[model samples]
Target: MNTPQKAIALGIGAALIQALMLIAFAWPAANTAPRDLPLAVTGPQAAMVTQKLNQAVPGGFEITRPADEAAARTAIADREVYGAIVTGDGAPRVLVASGASPAVAQQLSAMAQQLSGARPAAVEDVIAADADDPRGAAFGAMVLPLVMAGIAGGVLLSLLVPSVSGRLIGLVGFGVVGGLLSMAIIQGWMSIIPGPYPILAAVAGLVSFAVAGTIVGLATVIGQPGIGLGALTMLLIGNPFSAATTAPEMLPQPWGAIGQFLPPGAAASLLRSVAFFDGAAATQPLMILLAWAALALILLGVGFLTSRGRTPASATTVSAEPVPA
Candidate 1:
């Protein structure tokens, strides 16, 4: 295309990208509401309270009847539910885990007040978020920076490291350093996440490796376009759909579940589990992160083999060339 045409194309492309990004980031927040959010209810009025919730939200909650208040608390601690309601002769008690999701906790508190009508419900936090990030704003803000760091590491490795082995080394090195640095900032300095330093550092490193490795692996296999694809996936799709700022259940269906499978979403969930829930409900997210890291390794292996195959042919072509007299 000519210069003028190129300029016009670039402008249009930029506009389209901006529009897409706005939609991706804004749509979820705009439409945030509980969709099949888990809740446990127990006591004599459990059935009545469940019916009330159903009437109030209409498909908003998936209510489970625990044996009693103790069981309900267990469910919340295990991350099985966002909150629980215990109803009896006295005012009902609402149990919430703000560490799991501050938004959900707030919503539960409001719902309890509404249900109680004249009487105020007692709200208890089963797993409270760190005091430094009571509302989880700082915690939520950390996701983007970690994602950007991973993307940057992957892109730089692809551009600067020509060899597959070298790129692998770079990915590992970045994971270690980047993970430690991130933990130092978010945990040590900021105290946004409450957990042992080593464990949190390890989790941070895993996230970095999973994201960067996937990008590096793609670039190794498919060339430069892979880098763009990886970045777009992490930033546009993964970041927005991650549900890091709120609970996944608060997001629209299918997409909410879908986000949990992505690296950003998995990392966010895993971080919260380890930091506040004592590793409760961490299995799925941990597996997802490992799967991404493993995929990267497999792609790198393919790239290595492909490179090896070309090297012999290249050597043959060079050897067969006529030497200058």
Candidate 2:
């Protein structure tokens, strides 16, 4: 095609992708995840506990069978888990941990009571998050590290995609994970203002890989422009609505309900569940994030079918040879 044709195609294609990313991904990620979180548990040995626990999630957790109340208390202090369970005869009681999450702590009491069949879940939110913190921020805290790390990873990939050493992509991923853990220490122990440091770092690392992979995939599908699109999609579209600070539940209707499907919202909710809710509420959010990641990878594969360069980013250009349909 001539210069004019090429420019038109690029504009149309860019517009199309941007529109999809915004409508399908970024728009929703922001609206569902909450900031302040209430963390706790009912019966530690509640027979159904393990049954529920077996259901794995993408959020953070450390499930342990503590011996007694004292042991559970120590575990919360160590941050072994967000809260603890002390199994007893009637039902069970929750123990709140000052260091855990306050929103969860407050809500656990009422929620626990509601959960118990004979009585209730016997809520006892242990490990209180800070007063200034919002339940939505709890989710944000978990996702912030991941988003920041992913942002860094996206930038790094942009630099490395044009370079000779392709394997460095993997190296970059590893570095992101390392940075996440390191940041966690700084956030958690150092008393970072926003939220817990260590947890944020962990989430940041996870988000880094997911975002980097998406960026990589988009670059493959659209070449250099994918990087720009990724920024617009992941950062602009995903972050703001990603927390309960402005979740759909509080909103009037469908917009609020639909937010959880967005990338940031999914990850934020998953992280918040882990950070404040003892990972109790992570089932769907994890699935949403995985689905988005999978779709991005599929796009990357399609891009790879037609490109010629050694770098993955080159595949994104549309004029390349046909990917075997």
Q: Write the per-residue lDDT of candidate 2 for residues 1-325, one digit (tens) a residue.
A: 9999999999999998778757654555443332222122334464454334334221222356666677777666554454655566766676764334444444444434544457765544455554455343543455555565665666676566653235235634554666466555545554433444565555555555566667766776677787777766666556655643433333323544455676666765665556555655567877776676676557655665555445556566667677797
What are the clash counts of all predictions, listed in order?
Answer: 0, 55
lDDT of 1 by residue, 236-311 (tens): 9899989998988898878889989989999999999999988999999999999999999999999999987785
Per-residue lDDT, model 2, residue 274, is 62
TM-score of 1: 0.96
- What local distance difference test score does each model get? 0.92, 0.55
Best prediction by lDDT: 1
Q: What is the Cα-based lDDT of residue 17 in candidate 2?
A: 73
The all-Cα superposition gives candidate 1 an RMSD in Å to the true structure of: 1.8
> Model 1, stretches more than 4 Å misplaced?
312-325
Please give the lDDT score at residue 83 for candidate 1.
Answer: 91
Residue pairs that clash (backbone atoms under 3 angstroms), model 1: none
